[model samples]
Target: MLYSDKAPDPVGLYPHARRVGNLLFLSGVGPRKKGSKDIPGVTLDNHGNIIAYDIEQQCHAVFENVRFILEASGARWENLVDVTVYLTNMKADFATFNKIYATYFKENQPCRTTVEVNALPTPIAIELKCIAAFEDK
Candidate 1:
């Protein structure tokens, strides 16, 4: 009964499903809207904006967004086994990023890796991609 149900990723090119016995590997999700959200404030001209945003706020949203995707797929943050974070300004803002991230997976710490990048789909300051695992029941 292992199978992928939904994907949060905008580009549908990637398969959102993978199965191995009782395990499923869902694709990573970001904060970009499938279409658009009219997110307002001080957003990038080409994308949505946050008026009072810092690495902390953005990190929270990114994790929450991934949690939503996992829930839709019948999984939870506790099911996450690995998380990969991408940041445009990692060296400068990562301290706050890790702080916020700690709150989400406080109970279950998964293997994690963060990389610094030059840009992301949106100018939201931070982007997170994760892999979740749930026991088949």
Candidate 2:
């Protein structure tokens, strides 16, 4: 099991990542900063409903959180093999997300799947689940 002090706390009771054999499986990572409930680029109303969000900002933050978990699990960014992205508003966010994603994944192109969802566990707009592989040295 792996936990990262630099990554945001998971909404559920789960570690950041778990390593088995040569693979590390990361839990869903969001844009919230470590030890903070305020999600990046998200503006919520008084009732805690999302009023506005910046997909680009959320994308960068979630990627950084994923990096933190991968480092905690003894993996490298280049070792990422797969990524699953969940977006609350695909129609509004997909293009922006793809643009930001390409900038980070220019060299290490992992297999990816993106889907639209109604919402996440938090007010965040984006989340990522990842898998990485490394030699069992």
Which candidate leads the pack in TM-score? 2
Error of 2 at 94 (Å): 0.5
The global C-alpha lDDT for each of the candidates, from Candidate 1 onward, is 0.63, 0.91
Model 1 misplaced regions, further than 4 Å: 1-9, 15-20, 33-42, 46-53
Compute the lDDT of residue 12 as modeled in candidate 1: 48
lDDT tens digits, residues 1-137, model 1? 22233323455466544545545565555554434552212254443443344566556556666766666667777888888888778888888878778777789999999999887655556666666777767
In model 1, the worst 10-residue window by lDDT is: 38-47
Each model's TM-score, in the order given? 0.73, 0.97
lDDT of 1: 0.63
